[model samples]
Target: MSKVVLITGGSSGIGKAIGDYLSSRNYTVYGTSRNPDTIQNSLFPLLKMDVCNLESIESAISELIEATGKIDVLINNAGVGITGPIEETPTEEMKKAFDTNLYGPINVIKTVLPYMRSQKRGHIINITSIAGYMGLPYRGIYSATKSALEITIEAMRMETLQFGIKMTNVAPGDFATNIAAGRYHAPVLENSPYKEAYSSTLKMMNEHVDHGEDPSKMAKVVHQIIENENPKIHYKVGAPMQKFSIVLKRILPDKVYERMLLKHYGLK
Candidate 1:
């Protein structure tokens, strides 16, 4: 029998690419989205799920397990991003991001663990980002959410090992996707003291994403993780420079690393 894989935010971009790739490879793929109708044309079935809502997350998982018997893999790929100075970013926007990017994955895992425990075998893949390693200038809140998720996922792996559940956080670098269309941006450019700085950084950031890695590349990484009996605790998917940044974060002095980031984004 094919392994049943459940991926969140699969309506488009990275999630969609993963679902399609896995389905083609004969994995029993199911994706969750806010609107299943919108992705009816997709290769896999999509369950209606607003990951930020516990009731909705619970309902989606219950429905999936009821029909499929078990979810062999859970990919926590649903997330949103935000940008602005930490001081000036609106509280509501940050809350919205934390709800979706961090809390959503936490709640979904809580809901699914019972089934995985019963089966004594499962893999939970949390899709984070390289920015999580070191917070970005304009994207501080967004990076914080990912960093927090990475830390949480670390503990989850240790706790669930007894149940033979494998867990890992995949930190993707800038990947070409439609995330910009859904991003929650701050209104800092018009009246903020850092208006010029924000503009320059924003342009650089957007261009970087425009030329980022292919989303399909991350899908391949997912496939490899699924096939490997013991995958690494964290996987960073991107070009050499992007992946190596994580290493730089580990080895560089705080002041030097900070300077590098500032210079890279033209914030200096």
Candidate 2:
């Protein structure tokens, strides 16, 4: 039987890579991007969906279900990032990040759950971040958003096990994706209070992004987990730097970890 996969924020970056990878493997792929014109792939059915909008999410899911009759997998990869100190981050900006990164997935999960429950089988893959596990300066909002998603996804994994729903949280440290340059910085430039601070931190983050793993690598991992008979709850896709960071967080003392993060970002 052919599995049907629905991917959110599939217009670009990691989401787009995942969609292409699964589609290549013969899965019926439905991708939703907020901006439809940006989608060059007509082969995979594309719909316009802003994760912040509940109605749009519902409508897109309903349309997909109507056409396919069932969706076997949902990749909640739509998210946004905000770079600034938490105290300096605007209220609306924080809300925007959370809506896109956290609540957005919640809305999609709600819409997809009913259909999956009826079928008694489904897989939900959330594209979270290493920031979900570790905190760094100037990325407070983004970290918090992913942290919220991490906690929610973990709980969902436990709660939905009995219903035959599998939830996997894929945490990518940094990727050579347009997220930092395109998604986060663009928004910050328009409404930035600490323009210099935001720019410096964003520049540093983008430099890391350029040095990070390729999106295709993560796509391959996603394909593996989906095809696997037994899927793990978490998959970390990142460089040695990311792995080291995770280990440091686990082993280092609290103040030591804080100092390391601060020094690396020149916050110290």
Candidate 3:
């Protein structure tokens, strides 16, 4: 039988691209969205699910198992972006980002683990961000959320290994997607100290997304991870420089790296 794969936030963007590519390759693919009915002409079936809602996630997973008999792989691709100056961003907004981007994926994994454990074999691929490796000026909250998830997986991957289940994080750089439209952005107050820097950084961030690599590239990477018998704990997909930044952070001193980031964001 073809492997059964479940992807959250699959109605569009990277999730949709993965679903489409995997479906064409004969893997049974099911994507999730808050409103599956709203999506039309999706290459694979989409289940109604909200990662932030535990009940919804349980229901969707149960329904998927009932239909497919097994979930061979899961891609936790459901996440929201938040961009704002750390001090100016509302506490509530930051909590909301953590709720969706961090807690949301954890809850889904909690619900799916028992099933995967019973099967004694499965793969979990988390869709994190290249930004997760380090803090970005205006995108601090988003970075933190993904960074936390990356660390969580590092610990959980070991614990779950005994059950023959594999867990890994795939951090991708900016991809051409609708993520910018859905992300939260704290207003740039004209009088705020961060207004000038935040405004310019936000504009630059969007332009990067507008000219980002195709989501299909991310899909291909996901596919390769699924096929690998011993997937690494972390994999990054992006421009050479974007991937190199992670390495730079490792080899360079903290102050030097911070300065480099400041210059890159035009905040120096």
Candidate 4:
């Protein structure tokens, strides 16, 4: 039997791409969205699930289990993007981001682990961001959320390995997706101290997304990871420089790296 795969936030964007690719390859794929009915012409079935809602996650997982009898893989791809100056961003919004990006995925993992454990074999691939490796100006909250998830997986992967379940993170760089459309943006108040700088950085961020690599590339990398016998703890997919930035951070001095980031963001 083909492996049964569950992907959260699969209505569109990267999740949809993955689902489409895997389905074509004969994997049993089901995706989750807040409103599955609204999505038309989906390549795979999408269950109604809000990662921030434990009840909904449980319901969706139960339904999938009932239908497939086993979940061979779980992809925690549901997340939101938040961009603003750390101080200027609303505390409530930041909490919401953490709830969806961090706690949300954790809850989904909690719900699926029992089944995966029972099967004694499964894979959990988290869709993290390359930005998680380093803090970027204006997009700090988004970075923190993904970074925390990355660290959490590092610890959880070790614990879950004993059950014959594998967990890994695939951090993708800017992908050409509708993420920018959904991201929360703190209004650019004319009088706010960060008005000019924040506005410029925000524009640059959107441009990067607009010209980002195809989401299909990310799907291909994920397919490879699922096929691997001994997958690494972390894998990054993006442009050469984007991936290299992570390495630069490791070798460069703290201040030097910070300076480079500042220059890159045109904040210097």
Candidate 5:
């Protein structure tokens, strides 16, 4: 029997790439997107779901479960990136970032855990980022959200192990995706003292993304993890740079690592 995989935020980027790859592998794939019109493949069933909306998430999952009877894999890949200095980031904007990036995934997992528990078998992959491990200058808010996700996935992994379910966190370092260009910008604050600093940081981030890895490569790692019977708790995508970053963060002092991150992104 073909595995049934459900991917949130599968409308585009890495999520879309994974959906496309899985379909090619003969998996019965279902993707959820806020904008169904933007989805590339019409052949796979695409449901309109906003991860920030609990009702929409539940309804979509319910419909899928009713139709397919099981979700062998769930990909919590939906997220948003907000760029700005910590001091300049508005309260509302911060809330929105957390809602979609952190809490939204938690809600989806809660709703799906029951079915997964009943089946006593499933895989949950949380799409995190290198930012989760090391904070960036203008991306503090975005990094925090992913950091929360990383911590949550760790705890969830320990709890779910005995249930015969698996949880893997995919932390891909700079992938060439719409994310760099599609950052959610907060309303410009006039008379803000740090505006210049934030602008310089955002510009550096943009330039770094211009030379990042392709999103399709990240998709293949996702496919490999899905097919593995005993997947690792974390899958770091991208080139050796990703592993190097993790190792550097682990061994370097706070100031040294911060400086390296700034220099790596041209913020130095």
Candidate 6:
């Protein structure tokens, strides 16, 4: 039998692309959405699961395991985006973003570990973002969530090794997906001092996503990672310039890195 793979947020966007690509290559792919009925034309089965809900996650994984006997890989791609000035954004909104982007994956990872452990081998791929590498204007919450998830994945890399479970974070650069349309815009009051800056910055970032790289490119990169006998702990897939930014951040001074981000986002 082909290896079984489970992908969260596979209803669309990068998750959908990966689901399609992997299944076509003969991997027994299973994609999950909050409402499986909405998932159409998928090459593999659609499982109803909301990463934010523990019950939902448990039910879905249990069903997958019952039928497949084991889960060989899991792609934690379910996440939401929240944007606004960090100070103006309500605490509750940021919490919700964290719940979905960070906590949701944690819940899923924990649930799947026992299965992966008993089997003696499994791969857990966390779909992180380039935003995790740097704080972006108006997208501070999104960045924080992804950044936290990456840190957690790093810890799991060491913790899960003895069980033969490998955890890796895939930080994909800007990608054209439905994320822009679904992003929550934090409330910015009219009298807020950051109004003008917030407006311009939000627009700039959203458009960048609108014209981002194709999702299929990232899917191929993910495929390679899955096939590798031993994948690295972290992989950034996207434009050379975006990948270079990570390198620059590591070598450059703090002020220099901030300036580059400002200029790129038209905030300078």
Taken over the whole model, the C-alpha lDDT of each candidate is 0.92, 0.85, 0.96, 0.96, 0.86, 0.91
Residues 1-268, candidate 3: write the lDDT tens digits: 9999999999999999999999989999999999999999999999999998999999999999999999999999999999998998999999999999999999999999999999999999999999999999989999999999999999999999999999999999989999999999999998999889999999999999999999999999999999999889999999999999999999999999999999998888
Evaluate candidate 1 by giving its C-alpha RMSD to the native, one decimal. Answer: 0.9
- Candidate 6: lDDT of 60? 98
Candidate 3 lDDT at 6 equals 99
Error of 5 at 74 (Å): 0.2
Candidates' RMSD to native: 0.9, 2.6, 0.6, 0.5, 1.8, 1.1
Ranking of all predicted structures according to lDDT, beginning with the best and ending with the worst:
4, 3, 1, 6, 5, 2
Candidate with best lDDT: 4
- Write model 5 residue lDDT over 1-268, tens digit each, in one string: 8999999988778888888889989999999998887756455788889999999999999999998999899999999889887776788999999999999999999889999999999999999988888777778899899999999989988999898999999998887778866778654467777666667677777766777888889879999999899999887877797668889889999899988877766566
lDDT of 6 by residue, 26-115 (tens): 999999999999766778798999888999999999999999999999999998989998888889889889999999999999999999
Candidate 2 matches the true fold with a TM-score of 0.92
The TM-scores, one per candidate, come to 0.98, 0.92, 0.99, 0.99, 0.93, 0.97
Query: Between prediction 1 and prediction 6, which has the larger lDDT?
Result: 1
Tens-place lDDT per residue, model 1, 197-258, is 98788778788889888999999999999999989999988889888887888899989999
- Cα lDDT tens digits for candidate 2, 1-268: 6999999988888888888888888999988988887767456888888888888989999999899999999999988877776766678888888999999998899889999999999999999999888777778778889989999998988888898999999999888888875554333555557566666777888899888778999999999999987898888888888867888899999999999987887765
Query: What is the Cα-based TM-score of model 6?
Result: 0.97
lDDT of 2 at 89: 65
**Candidate 4 residue-wise lDDT at 33:** 99
The reply for model 3, stretches above 4 Å from the true place, is: none
Model 2 misplaced regions, further than 4 Å: 185-199
- Show the lowest summed lDDT stretch of 10 residues, model 6: 180-189
Q: Candidate 5: which stretches are off by over 4 Å? A: 37-40, 187-191, 265-268
Candidate ranking (TM-score, best to worst): 4, 3, 1, 6, 5, 2
